[model samples]
Target: MSGGIHADTAPKPVGSYPHARRVGDLLLLSGIGPRIPGSDAIPGNRYDADGRLLHYDIVAQCHSVFANVRAVLEASGARWQDLVDVTVYLTDMAADFAAYNAVWQEYFPDPATAPCRTTLGITALPTPIAIELKCIAATGAGARR
Candidate 1:
């Protein structure tokens, strides 16, 4: 079954796109950020009077982003355990990867059941968020595969 999915519980996307799309036995999530729903607030953001980004909390962003992903997956009738792959982006990997990896350990404790992952260091995001997640979770027959 192939269809586009929208998660009302998830924060509205920054651009024109559905929350996720289901193709065959897979649910492919869009780039999910740490923006809080309804308010579209990014956690851990601190700015100066000039709106220049100052210090941001990678820990808060990590948890918030994971929550957003969970919202989308649950809305799309998928489970965190069903995730087969994930791609992550971080703006300051050199400075934040350790904290980020620590947070990752919290969500995904066991390597055996964890999804395959690839992470990349990027210059900046479209928004002020420090991290974003791209996820692929299994469904229907794919869950059995």
Candidate 2:
């Protein structure tokens, strides 16, 4: 059986999808952005009414993104330490990787316990956000085939 998890504290998905899904012992999270819940405001993004990019702050964006991820994890009965893998997408790698890495380290702390990660540079996202996260977590329940 499978179940979906929606976090009231996290931004509502832009598409028709839940924040996460549980299949057996794993919780698969949808791509999470840094947009504030309800307001739909994106941190670190500065755009005009015409929807043009103005400026971006990678650190601030990372903080909000991580927090949003945590909210979904908690809602799904998972924890940061339960995360097994993560996929990160960045709109501008050359300019943002260093700052993003620094902020990421603040959460993972120890390399040994950190989840495996793969980061890629992308051209754009659904919103004006600079970064997003897709995660998989262990649910601590027995696996079912």
Candidate 3:
């Protein structure tokens, strides 16, 4: 078993974690924040569809949060189809539940490609960040091969 999938190149890690790591057949990713690439500032915590900030709407945060997930996967030379499992940690479950699912569907448009998932409600996260996603993906050269 090759048990390895190297990135084309590595990006600057966000915090105290590697961007992604390959173990055996699995590519494991750390939780990504709402910050976009090339910037340290995180995205809006809450905003409307039209880009108006909303104090109580967490839907906006969920979108950016998942976008960050996509960024990490792309940087690691994988796609959403390679994903086998996901673990989501949320600080505010009630506010984020609906937003999470709706935005998730947008990214994971195909039900067949959907990964097994576990979403947990927690009291707090690293920042006031409402959502964070960590994922496991099997690469073609490894298990998916």
Residues 1-145, candidate 2: write the lDDT tens digits.
5767899989999999999999887899999999987878888778889988899888989999999999999988888888989999999999999999999999989888898899999999988889999999986654221
Decide which is better by TM-score, 2 or 3: 2
Candidate 2 regions with alpha-carbon error over 4 angstroms: 141-145
Top of the candidates by lDDT:
1
* Local distance difference test values of all predictions, in order: 0.92, 0.90, 0.69
Residue 2 in model 2: lDDT: 76
The candidate that achieves the highest TM-score relative to the unseen native structure: 1
Candidate 3 local accuracy as lDDT?
0.69
Q: What are the clashing pairs of model 2?
A: none
* Order of quality (lDDT): 1, 2, 3
Going through the candidates in the order shown, the clash numbers are: 0, 0, 0
lDDT for position 4 in model 3: 31
As for candidate 3, its clashing pairs are none
- In angstroms, give how far residue 32 of model 1 lies from its true place: 0.4
How well does candidate 2 score on lDDT at residue 38? 83
What is the TM-score (0 to 1) of candidate 3?
0.76
Write one digit per residue (lDDT tens) for candidate 3, span 3-94: 33333333245466576787766788877656555654455546679955465346767777666666767877777678889998887788
